[model samples]
Target: MSLDSTLHEALTALNQGRYKTVLKVAKSGMKRYKSHPAFPNFAGIALSSQGKHRDAAGYFKKALGLDPTFHDARRNLAQALILLQQSDTALTLLNRLLEGAPKDPDGWYLKGQALLNCGQPRAAADAATRSLELNTRQPRALNLRGVARNMLGDEAEAIADFQTALTLNPNDVEALVNISLPLARQTRHAEALEAAERAVHLAPTHLNARLRLAMQLLESGDQDGARDQFQTILGQAPGHAQAIEQLAALNAAAANADLEPIARRALKTAPRQSSDAARLHFALARMARQAGEQEKFASHLTQANGALAHIMPFDSDGDSQQFESLRTRFNAGADQVQAPAPSGPTPIYVLGLPRSGTTLTETLLGAHPNVCPLGERAVPGVLLAPFLENDIAFDTAACAQFVARDQERLPALPDGIRFYIDKMPENYRLIGALLTAYPHARIVHMCRDPRDVALSMWQAHFSGKALSYTYDLAAMAHRFNLYAGLMAHWHSVFPGQILDVQYEDLVTDVDGQSRRLADHIGLKWVEDMAHPERSTGPVLTLSANQVRQPVHSRSVGSWKPYETMLTPFISGLDPNLWPGVQQG
Candidate 1:
């Protein structure tokens, strides 16, 4: 028999949960074909069975090098790296697989899973969407996409995706488990409870679902149920990280209403040397910032950064090429301004530098009974890219062609909800093409103090090439300036449609800014709009926790803490625009 055949038999046994058989077959295969691709594959299986995960990763890497098309080896390598607590490497490999084989649903699904692990929701959604394109019936791909959407701040759409996945395959444990994640994020205790129970029935050992149920119960102010669930999970898998962390958090939350205190307690008590500290600290800092405790928040943040910074190096493309290409394609002449009528639906884009309150703004507008929030979906830029001619010329025919194509896919909505909000913050770079396509769409560009916005962005890990300037501070300033110039050009091209709102102004005088925002879109001031901070829909963005609280200028001068480190990046930009940096 061929070496691959022997390796396949061993893999089949491993997939069938016969670890002993896997060991036996794998050992024989490894001894006979030590230098072949199947040799490494079998060796990886044998090492993994023996709990030697690092060694298994090495073997899988060798197997992949020997046979680049051995996707199974890459997948196995990624999982093994995860076991070794090397999530960044695993995610990078998964991303490579996704791009190399866009038609492979499994590759996309794996990339989505890795992205979810790393907390980059939009990229995960993009991968999942690609996976769906390849195999619409792929329940796992659909479920993963739903998870990504839910994380990116679209609760209703996420629910729809999960529901669709379940319709396709009734026994999808991950889908059942994830259904409750969005509910918890939205603070829907009752619905989350039902979903949690269903998940447990479908998968008796579904830790994440069980953890979600416990968290929902706790957050709903049900201590007894929360305690029981945590204890039950501990009984099955002692020292389970989720149970320990969530239980501690539950205990802390029960003691104080502010949540920051509880978060601090959890961080102190969490076991040292675990890779989860970064996320925990990130959660704490956001809550603390909300509670108006800058010092404590900064401390937790320092700790979190220390943990994640080691692994989460900015993974975005650093090239200025995509932006240049995009700009060159849609150099629509600025002299002609097409007068827009009150005919088609207005595209109200909530644009800003990422992490500078776009989600908060979207939620604020979405709370208005008249608007539908299409959270962070970069459809406008994605729409215009193909239609624009290569030399900055607008092709009206091509633009019209794409608009018709897109309008067909937009979900049907109820009456009185006329305006649609595309909250893609990075769309600030593409406001020019956006006007050419819609002509009638409203653009709300949200700006914060450059330092604060840059700092907020500095700490955050964005997934797109649009925010590629984020890794270096000077680069960020230059990009921000370019964006400013672009927005200026957009205003010159189509004046009166683009409205600028300083994020600082928005929070400082929310009622006043909101009124102006409402009037710009021609909507009357509604009392419910102010309650956007308390929006109960699943917010699927990094700001998911932040939007649930009232707006504040607490983040202003936020770069003060990192002033020393940011000096270079600050000096690199146009200093006059951002006044926070020390002048020479």
Candidate 2:
């Protein structure tokens, strides 16, 4: 056969998914036409199909060197680069492809995927939108856009996009898997589980689908199911670092000795300063702590946090400036904006630093027949964004606009529900705006010991960039100080409108504190409020595992074990804010 016929045979084999056959034919063609780009490109495609991304990238590079304008080779090379986690290079190549062929929807779609992997979700969304503009029926673009939207904290819109992508191509495993995230975020766990299960069923061997299902199971409190799923993933791909790390975490509380080897292996293979290494180290730290190896625990914790700090560096100065601006704007408008009379079912705002019993309080309240719990919704931030944009002076008009916008976005409350809880911990920063908009809305400010709060924040790994300050001890302390100052300001302005619920007190005196919380929210005391562990709804926060168990005082002074390492955080805190606590 001629060289062209041989290349054609390789392309046919590739299209048929006979990757080995494609490779065999491509190698023969390459020996005959040694300098031809098509043969190398064919081999690259086969290697990529076989999951040898690094090897595929080298072949693709050779193809591009032989033929600079080979668009197919260039696209394949970019894909291999992305698969190798070299999104920066993939992005550069995709940009060149788009520059040469501006109408290429695939190029735009690939660019969107690259941008999303690079942590530029906003840019990814824009790129996905551009791709859809060129090819409206593109399911991949819709799915990519949905992922970007979810990352941007727009779960509702993200769900819509995912649904559209599924409609366009029901077999799209990524869409099926990704739709579960926003569904889970919305507290629709059953639907999320169903979506994840469907994704796994559709593509049983797909690592992402299995991982998504495992995560959903874990979040739904099905630890055994999640463990089985993670174990299966590891069995299929022993070097699956994420699965190994997650298994370590799942078993960390129990100090499962079997996980130690897996954790060590994952840590050994994971890239330095990568999130996977951080997760494995944190898991090892937990296991050590559980086993009472305090010295080893401290060492592992330090190493884990060091890895996280390197990967997700906190911008202390920028964060301080942002917090200062929030304080300045809210303080400036405190006198100018008249508090509106609260009407309708009053919103119960659960405001506090993360891991400070906000989830517990909300879960307890949500168990009541009269209250609905909306777990950590982004509506408050969305409503307040307009007021905070461009240093705009917040006034009565801004307050009214915020209230109107928030009311429109508010989800429908259950029948006979007296109040709904918005349990977004970060809403503490928006207490001034919240009270200004809804004067009658009950505010529950959950406070914990600063040391414990800082320690918990440091130990935990948050999913998004929103809590980057938590990675550093000093930054966490600084953010905590800002929170305390803002809460004090809110107290001065709102007076009796805000209720302070101490986490330590709540856990120690469950019944008494529960009654106080009930009275503050204008609800009659119910036995269910005292037993939040029995709550039916999903606890979506990092406190998911904690709230599922009975309230205990075990976590009250957890920082004591690591006190020596937290000197900077404790010393940096405002002593007055933590009454009775001595500064280091």
Candidate 3:
């Protein structure tokens, strides 16, 4: 057939959804028209339509080689590269494309997807925004923007974007799966789980959708459901590292048959610095700890944290500057903001370093009849961000604005609820602002042994960049020192306003400390408060499993087992923070 007739036939077949006929025509044409880029490009489209990205990439590359300036072939090549998980290369091609066609919304959207894949969420979000600005009706762009925003810690904006995308296409599984994260971050686990379930329902064969559903199930305290979902994933993709890691965590205590071995084998092949490696190592570390293989535990923990270091390295200078900024703002106790009295439930701010018993404390408080636990709300951090970022005076006027906004941000509390808890451990940083905004609010500071806190933080896998410092022992110690200094400042500045609950003391004498905490917060001591394990509410924090059991002192000296591996943390800590451990 003549080249014109061949090209016309191939185009017609491609446009008619006859991918096989298009491919056959393209392959036949490629031999006769060796210089024609269209033949190879057509073959690539057909192959990519059939989900053969690797072969599609080769054909697209050949097409690009034939005609380097062919924009259509270049765009197709970039997309194939992205699908083949070569996002860095895709990004380079996309940057060149966007430079030539600056107004191309599709180019911006592709760049956004590539950036998101490459872990550049800020850049990805910008790209998505540019794309959306150019073409507001693109649901995929909105979905991409939501994913990026979620990664950048803008959960509210991310959810809004996802909701907008869903409104555009209710069957968008990608939007449904992506929305679960920010929803879960806001402690709306049920909604998150529902979103995940819908995604899995829409795309039953999508591994990521099922994986997310499994995670949501686990977080929602449906362990059996999570295990089944994970098992289902493994049945299809046996080498899935995330599934192996999560299943390992579920079966760690029981030491399920061959489960540890399976996890160990997966860990051997996973990329050294990937989150998968971190998760697998953490799971193995737990297994080692459970089996009393302390040395193995130390090794796995070290590797786990090392992997996280590559992904989210701590910023010591930034953390110190933040501490200094907070000190400068609240050291002298700013004039109390004269905002109107809050008519809602008085907030009980549970503040401390992560893994310093904040979850346990919150659980105890939540057991109270009048106290509703709103787990780890980002209200304070969000409120403090503008002031900190812009260097605005957090004076009486700013404080009044903060108080009014704080009230506005909170969900409506049910009637008869006397106190609600916001137990984000890092809220300790904003205690001054929190009190300034709500003078009637109660502050409970959880104090744990610095060694235990450091070790625990190192072991825990936090969801976002907010606690990235936990990956580095020295960074955790530095933050701990800052926490120490800040707590002392709060005590001096607001004498008798904040209650210090020693985690060790609380665990050892649950009854006594529980009453003390209840009294300090003006809560009537209830027998239920002493036994938080009886409460069947969702425990979404890292200490989820431990909190569901009766409070115990086993974790008190937990650092002793890994004392030899904790040199970096030990060296950076203030001696006063080390309660009873002998420092070398």
Q: Which candidate is the best by TM-score?
A: 2
Q: In model 2, what are the clashing residue pairs, if there are any?
A: none
- List, residue by residue over 239-299, the lDDT tens digit for candidate 2: 6767866776667565458778777877888887888777877778778877899888878
Which is the winner by lDDT between candidate 2 and candidate 3? Answer: 3
lDDT (10s digit) by residue, model 1, range 49-155 = 77999989888988988899887788789878877767678888887775676577777777777776776778889878887888889888888888777655566
The candidates, ranked best first by lDDT, are: 3, 2, 1
Question: Candidate 3: minimum summed lDDT over ten consecutive residues — where?
Answer: 332-341
Q: Report model 2's TM-score to 2 decimal places.
A: 0.90
lDDT of 2: 0.84
lDDT of 3 by residue, 45-105 (tens): 9999999989998998899899888788888889989997889999999989888888989
Badly placed stretches (over 4 Å) of model 2 are 1-3, 21-36, 62-68, 239-255, 332-335, 338-345, 382-389, 393-412, 576-580
- Number of clashes in every candidate structure? 4, 0, 0
Please tell me which model should have the higher TM-score, number 1 or number 2.
Answer: 2
For each candidate in the order shown, give its overall lDDT on alpha carbons: 0.69, 0.84, 0.84
lDDT of 3: 0.84
